[model samples]
Target: MRPLIAIPARFSARTSALRYAAEVNARSLIEAVWRAGGEPVGIHPADTGTAARLARFDGVLLPGGGDLAPPATAPPTPTTPSTTSTPSRTPSTSTSPGTPWSRACPCSRSAAASRP
Candidate 1:
């Protein structure tokens, strides 16, 4: 069986076909996972039962969108580059051990290849 990947959907104010608000996962992102032989599951972005749900999946693909809410105590920072001169890199935010988000695989250049 292919690995089941959990991709949390983001809220869209509207979708072309839907009359009301909608939850959406990126089509291209879903296609990429499918092409790579993984099952992409679109899940509601809820705060409860996260760890249990994540434990059921083989891998996770954090979708391209806004950053996850910063740790409550810290001030907000721009995730984007301030100037073109500076090199671009995604900053890592540390989380506590045994948390669901911490279970996500680190995507280093060497680890770009997704696995089940």
Candidate 2:
């Protein structure tokens, strides 16, 4: 039996075929999964009983496309010019299971300096 892959459908305000708001998934993604010998299933984006429903599927494919919101407590902006500066340091590399290698700066430096 082929593995069942659960795909979370992307929600859009308006689509060309459907004039009203609708939940949809990419056709290419579903076809690719099927070609790879996996059964692709569309899942509703509801919070209720999601964990129980997903238990039946062998794997999950989370496609991007969602709203983003800033944190409630905003960081304080610097008003005064800084006189001192720290030297740039190289980022350290690490790897985890089933994930690509990642690089991160040491925690000793300021957040702004760490950003690429």
Each candidate's lDDT (Cα)? 0.64, 0.55
Task: Please give the distance, in angstroms, between residue 29's alpha carbon in candidate 2 and its true position after superposition.
Answer: 1.5
Error of 1 at 20 (Å): 1.1
Local accuracy of candidate 2 as per-residue lDDT tens digits, 1-116: 87777778877799888879988889866766676666878988887777677767765555544452212112223743332221113335332333211223222133234345
Q: State the lDDT of candidate 1 residue by residue for 1-116, as single tens digits.
A: 87777889999999998899999998977877776777888989998888888877766677644564433323445753333223123325434565555544333222345533
What number of clashing residue pairs does each candidate have, in the order they appear?
0, 0
The TM-score, computed over Cα atoms with residue i paired to residue i, of candidate 1 is 0.61
Give the best candidate by lDDT. Answer: 1
Alpha-carbon deviation at 41 in model 1, angstroms: 0.3
Error of 2 at 55 (Å): 0.6
In candidate 1, where is summed lDDT lowest over 10 consecutive residues?
82-91
